[model samples]
Target: MKLVQKWTVFMLGLLVVSFGIVLTIRAELGVAPWDVFHIGLSNQFSFTVGRAGQVTGFVIILLSFVVGKIKPTLGTIANILLIGFMIDLLMLVVSSPTNLIIRYFYLILGTVIFGFGAGLYISAHCGTGPRDSLMMALDKNLSYDISIIRGGIEVGALSIGYILGGPVGIGTILIALGIGPIVGLSLNKVNQLKNKLQPKIDCYN
Candidate 1:
């Protein structure tokens, strides 16, 4: 059933996001590169992560509409809501870091959870999120190894976060090193499950 499939995707997406948040909470030092940049930009302009994320999502969605012919979809709206809501909620549960170590752990857990959600939520292929759009664009433009390009983009984002007052601590480091593989593994697993459980679905690309 379409409803059942969407439900499964929603639940899995929640788990993935929760896991990433855990990492973010644990990586006490700071955020990974991209988040750091986004958070940093938010701070420089006196905005919350949720607001920034939504704004960014809107901008990227518009761009996608122009370039890739991506029409508005429920999943796209969900992406904006999901990130914005969680970032706001986290401001309550994840406190300002007292030390570098605390931030390190928070970020690590958050990254894992985030990656997990990316794999699960993205399987729906309803639409790509803001951050993902940037990556896909870079992947096409650079015409080189995707992982390397991604790493470069992350570093740039982290630098921006540093300037914006985001935590550029141990958490950032852990994410730079670990989060990619976790996402890849999760995507692979999700794909396998999809193939076995429902072969007719054409969600994943």
Candidate 2:
């Protein structure tokens, strides 16, 4: 890829995160499971989720590093900024949904957008997001199946969110279930894209 195109992809990743933020606030159904926890923490402690995400990412990245995992890279930076950007977008422009239907639709939108963004940035082979990091940690430490482990993560996070004063409703449950399929679809596309790019990169080398 040309320098210009690579730069474009990087910038697009940021936009995708910003878009996710808007969808989240507009969804107003409450944040997705992990985000619900972050938001709840933020609300209770008077910190924004984005800032919390960054701090969480820093800790997770350090832990992963200590484990001899992938070193930090631009995707790591993106993960940090993405949530921060979302928080800023939330504070600046987006508003809560007015009704249940709109709220649900907003969550669906947020899921798709967030999944797509995560797919793209993750495909960069840089680093996983903070939430993804937490999920992987659970999967590793508990030696559980991905589905079961992820389910536990969501259930645990949502419960924490509930305790922390985040909204929990049908949407919370829906998002927990819905995010997996949507993200799987998005990541499949990203994997295909990565496969297609590999030969070109290999050729250049």
Candidate 3:
């Protein structure tokens, strides 16, 4: 894998991630926990979800710097801008289905897609997005399992988002409980596939 390949994977992963996020919004059952926070900010501040996400990304990036003493990578910067824009763009064209069965389908599909996208970005190894960076930093500093740290982050975000009037439903709880394991599973599968396809060089390159 070359630098260009890494970048392409990173960008594609973000696009896929954003599309999945939009799908969840369209599902209308609820959203992922961090997204619940973003929606809350959007509602309270009179901004779009993308705008709120970008602002939150900036804040999280700064926190990552403070905690990890690392500068944002090009991948990180791209993740912040690209996912935000993609979500807004997708929202313009997509809408929620009225049927209950269809809505639940979208929710499950979106969560799975989001998990796979996250795995792809992590496999790219260019860098992590701001929120993920913060989570990783905390995991390192606190010597906790990634799963535990992720759950804690979700709980914190959910609590704050709820307080700030973010929408919550069964889907939120589903995402909160399932995302970590899904992401880990996806990561393993992706790495295995990458290794089988290109055994000579590091997939991250």
Off by over 4 Å in 2: 1-7, 63-74, 135-142, 190-205
TM-score of each: 0.74, 0.75, 0.89
1 or 2, greater by TM-score: 2
Candidate 2 residue-wise lDDT, 48-103, digit = tens = 76776666668766775655454666666676776586666566676776888877
Superposed Cα deviation of residue 179, candidate 1 (Å):
1.3
Number of clashing residue pairs, candidate 2:
0
Q: After superposing candidate 3, which stretches have Cα over 4 Å from the reference?
A: 136-149, 199-203
- Give the runs in model 1 whose Cα sits over 4 Å from its true position: 7-15, 22-27, 63-74, 94-105, 136-152, 199-205
Clashes of each: 31, 0, 0
Every candidate's lDDT:
0.69, 0.66, 0.86
lDDT of 1 by residue, 7-97 (tens): 5686568556744754574455666676776677787887777777677678866775666555656766777777677767766675656
